[model samples]
Target: MQKTFSEKILAKYSGKSHVVPGEIVEVIPDIAMSHDNTAAISKTFAKIGVDKLYNPDIHLVVLDHCVPPANEAFAQNHKDIREFVKKHGIKKFYDINNGICHQVMAENGHCLPGTIMTGSDSHSTTYGAFGAFGTGVTRSETAVIMATGKIWFRVPETMRINITGEFQDGVYVKDLALGIIGKIRADGALYMAVEFTGPAAGKFTVSERMTLCNLAVEMGAKVGYVPPDEVIFNYLEGRAAAEYEPVYSDEGCNYDAVVDMNLSELEPVVACPHTVDNVKPVTEVAGETIEQVFVGTCNNSRLDDLAILAHVLKGRHIDSSTRLVVIPASSKVMIDAMRLGYIETIVSAGGTLATPGCGPCMGNHLGVPATGEKTISTANRNFKGRMGNRESEVFLASPHTCAVSAVTGKISDPREIPVDMALIFSELRKATLSPVLMTR
Candidate 1:
């Protein structure tokens, strides 16, 4: 049967030859991930009366959200998670030193093409960049997956997003993602599976591809995917586990909707104030003063991302009025940036490099903005109070824009400055370092 990339993978995991949209199937996911919220998931697991995990090895837990624990309550939560891991012999566990759950999975080898993985975090869709079918589930739902290794899903209809044209200098994948989300609106693809294709998609590296799928949830998608190809294959060759089959969409497969985007016309767009869909070209809002500029998050904090910032900030410092904060997505990414000297470049340019974790992006830890202040960040969300005080504003944009704006203390257009494409590409190439090996 003809099927989209997601449908094909779902069918394979459900033990079927074919599956249709809206069909409910029981799928045994290749991996189930949880983070600091694992404490809550553990509670649900107990309430469900499950004494042992269906397969402890398939379960991954990472402590990140409030790393080091903000206070006593959070400290106890981490303690509960550690106890759970110890008692259950969960071998895939990662402590605070690891970083964001999504990045940990990708940097390691847990998320691979042709496999379906679900996490309790919304950005679980980030794994789709590696050609895996990734979706977010509730903590309770995660508990069930831990207990049974199986979860039911309604095969979502597919949305084909085809792009043709090359990005102009100074524009990055983060800009493209924000543009797509803005055009599609917040709920545009509700419960649908989005598949990226076309010349533009082909131009993206595995890291850039992650930005596309990472924001799929912003469009209300159940999951997002990119078909496996040589680019992704090369990325996974040494990093991904060797046991899974690769999956892709058939040529004649059906799609519920098709959106064609011309990349050449895309600009440095930002999601303003209170919504991911409230986007406008930076040109439309330039000169809007900002108090802080953040350049890392699960959606944009890979090694490549930090390298881009370093390249942009080389021999330059941010505006004295703006506080620049940088958080590496994971310790693996952080170590790589340091080895490449990108960390030094960033710090020398006045960017504060925080530990590997989701710092300040969720307003739960460091770098939270003050009331009435404004921040420009690479994070996926821009809702009120998302990054600190409710009165403060958050604007989402590409790392290039975020860095350049940090220099100006305002919403700035990245295109206003000449970009050294050669330098950026060199950094991007160096960014694909091998994942750090962790002992089981």
Candidate 2:
């Protein structure tokens, strides 16, 4: 019988000839990732009475959520994780300077095509950009994986989103993601694998594709995937650490649902203050004042994102009342942005640069908004109290929208701001072609 990508991959890893949705199968993931929360997982691992990891080579530990330690408690958590890594001799460890765990994994060659990876963070689905079967598990589940190197998965039904048409100016991949979430609501694809296909899928660069998968968890998807192609192969050329065989769904494969999205019909949109699914076109909420503008997160912090921010704020200053903060997704992305002068342009335009990590995305540290204040951010979620302060508000949008809002000090539409797409794309090309980004 024809099978979906999820069914085929799970079957291969589980050593089965064929498997279907809802079947539980045991398999060992190619990579298991954990971030700041690893400290807690380590404790649970120790409780399991396993003095050593089942396979150190399969584990990746990254300290990113509260880099440099937000306080005494957070510092202790980092310290515990470091000790755990050193004790276990985990070779794939990255310290706080590395950046977000998901970005670090992708850049360091851990997110290969046709492989299975699990992480403690929900956005672990970001690995699907490279066509990997990536998912997030509970902390206890992560601990179990660390101790045993084996995990069981119940295969999920597949949902296909076939996108068509080219993106309009100022309308971006982020808008598409938000539009989908708005239409389907938060629980739209709970415990299901969402596959992105159709002609437009090939047109998105690898970085753009990452955005598509990174937000999959926001809609309650178990995982997301985009079939690997030459674009993905080109990205993994020098970066991939292991040999991989790409996987694809069969032509006659069954799917739980099939949705079509027309890119030309989309406009710049934002997830409103309280929920990710409460999205509205930018024009509908224009003039809502903001106190802070954040342009970084695992979802939208990269060289391409920085280039867009710099392009929008070039030779212009932000609103004096608003604070603008920018953080690159990874150390490599940070270096490339610096070399391309994106950092200098942003800093000169009244933007504050923070250490490359998940700064302010979780409200753990760095640029948390004051109580009763409003922020326009590029993060995937905007639920109440998401940014540390229960009374503050966050509006989620694309980097383009965040940059424009920083200048206007309100929830403004990016299309209203004159941007030279040609110039922005030219700068991005320079950053993309840099050798620093090509390193594994």
Candidate 3:
């Protein structure tokens, strides 16, 4: 029987001739990842009475959230994690300077194609960008994986999303992601795998593809995949840590639902104050004043994102009433942006650069908005208190929209800003060619 990508991958990992949706199978993960919360997971592992890991090689620990220790409690969490890593002799460990766990995993050659990875964080689905069958599990599940190197998964039905046409100027992948979420609502694809396909999906660069997969969890998807092709192969050329065989769905494979989207019909859109699915075209909410503009997060904080923000803000200053905060998703992204002068341009334009990590995206510290203040951010979610203060509001948009809104101190359409798309693309290409991105 023909099978969807998820079915095929799950079958391969589970040692089955074929698997169907809702069937549970046991499998060993290529990597089991956890971040700062590993402290909690470590405690659970200790309770299980496992003094050693089943396989230290398959475990990857990263310290990102609340890095540099926002306070004593956070500091203690990091301290406990370090002790756990050393005690278990886990070689695949990254400290506070590495960046977000997902980006660090990709840049370090861990998120390979045709593999299975589980993380303690929901956005583990980001690994699907490389054709990996990635998903998130609870802290208890992760602890169990650490002890036995095994986990069980119930195969999910697949949802297929097809795209056509090119993105219009001032519009981006973030807008497309928001538009899809708005149409489907938050629980539309609960516990299902989402496959993004078609001409437009094929055209996105690997980093852009990452953005598409990163937001999959926001729509309640168990995972999201962009079919592996030359773009993926080229990215893994020097970066893949292990050999991988790419996988694809069979023709006429079954899908629970198929959604068709036309890129040409999309415009600059934002997820308004309270929720990710509460989206509206920028024009519908123009002139809503903002106190802060954030241009970084795991979903949008990459070199390409910085190039767009820098290009738009070049030689222009942000509104005096609005504060701009920028954070690169990883140390590598931060270095590339600095080498390309994107950092200088943003700082000169009145944006403050924080340490390269989650920063204010999680509202843990760094750049949280004051009570009753409003912020336009590039983060994937805008739930109440998402940015730390329950009274502060967050409006989610693309980096282009956030940059433009910073200049106007209001929710504004990016098309109103005159920019040379060609120049921005050229700079981004230059950044991609850097040696830092080409190798581990």
Candidate 4:
């Protein structure tokens, strides 16, 4: 029987000849990840009454949220997570100094194609960039996996999205993602897996693909997949830990729906305050005043993203009225940005750099705006109160758009800024292609 990529992977892991959507199966995960939330997961693990982990190697604990601890309680949470890691002899632990868990996982060779991995964070779907069957689960489900190294899934039907054509100057992968989510509606793919295919999808770099898959959850997708090919293989070279069986959807596999998109028709887009699907082309919101601009997050903090922004701000300074805060997704990304002088370029342009973690992105502490203020961010999600004060608003856009807005002190279209495409592409090409820093 022909099977979709999700079905094929689940069937292989579950030892079944065939599995269909709506069917539940017990399968072992290649990796089970948690972060500062591990404290909560540990409570569930304790409730499960398990003294030892099913497989210490497969369990990963990262410290990202509330990094450097916001308060005594947050500090205690990390303390408890450390104790849990030590108690179970878990070797895949990453402390606060490591940066975001999703970024760390990908950079450290834990995410590979054709593997099943789940985490307690919604953005765990970030692994799908490498063609992994990745998804997020509740703490209870994660605890069950902690005790047994196994979890259950109701195999989802697949929705195929085929994209073609080249992205015009000033537009990027983030715009494409927001465009798709807006068109599909917030819950269009509820409980389904989305497969991205076609020329445009293939043209994207691994980091660009990560930006797309990371936002899949916002579309109500259970998971999003980009089939592993030369791009993935190239990124994983000397990085992937174990031999992987490459998998793809069969030619005749069933799909619940198939959507075709032409990248050439797209314009830089953004999601207005209070919703991820309330998207509009940049021209629609041009000149909207903004008090701040943010240019980093798990979704858009990659080297290519920083390089693009740096190219735009080479000799210009950001608007004095609009504050700009830049955070690298991981320490390694931070180091790369510095080595390439992108860090200096941005800083010299009046951008403030935050530590390498999820700061301000979740409204935790850094760069919080005043009530009623507005911000344009490269991070996914723009729900009210997501970036502090409920009255303050966030407009989500591509890094290119954010850079231009930071310079203008208002939401602005990148098309208004003159850019040398040849120089921008050259700088982008200099970014490391390896998904994981093989040597660092």
List TM-score per model, in order.
0.96, 0.97, 0.97, 0.96
lDDT value for model 1: 0.85
Candidate 2 — which pairs collide?
Answer: none
Q: What is the C-alpha lDDT of each candidate?
A: 0.85, 0.89, 0.89, 0.87
Any runs in candidate 4 off by more than 4 Å, and if so which? 428-440
Residue lDDT tens for model 1, 279-349: 99889999999999998888998876777788878889999999999998888788889888989999999
Superior candidate under lDDT, 3 versus 4: 3
Position 10, candidate 1: lDDT = 81
User: Largest lDDT belongs to which candidate?
Assistant: 2
Candidate 3: which stretches are off by over 4 Å?
432-440
What digit string (tens of lDDT, one per residue) describes model 3 on residues 1-440?
88999899899988899999999999999999999989999999989987889999999999988878899999999999999999999999999998989989988889988899999988899999889988988899889998998898999999999999888888899999999999998888899999999988888877777888999998899999999887788888888889998889999999999999899999999999798999999999999999999988889988888888998889999999999999898888888899899999999999999887888887898899999999999998888988899999999999999999999999999998957777766666666432222110
Q: For each predicted model, how many residue pairs clash, with residues at least 3 apart or on different chains?
A: 0, 0, 0, 0
Tens-digit lDDT track of model 4 for 1-440: 78999999999999999898999999999999989889899899889887888888888998988778888998999999999999889999999887888888888888899999999989888889899999998888889998998899999989999999888888888999999999998998899999999877877777888999999999999898998888878777788867787889999889999988898989999899889999999999999999999998889987777877898899999998999999888888888788789899999999999887888888887788898899999999888899878989999999889999999998999987757756655655555632321110
Global lDDT of model 3: 0.89
What C-alpha lDDT, on a 0 to 100 scale, does residue 108 get in candidate 2?
78
- CA lDDT of 378 in candidate 2? 94
Ten-residue region with minimum lDDT total, candidate 4: 431-440
lDDT of 2 by residue, 1-440 (tens): 89999999999999999998999999999999999999999999989998888999888999899888879999999999888899889989999889989888888788999999999889999999899999998899888998899998999999999999988999989999999999998999899999999999877777788899999998899998998888888778988989999899999999999989999999999999799999999999999999999998999988888888988888899999999999888888988898888899999999999998998988888898899999999999898999999999999999999999999999999997867766766666676532222211
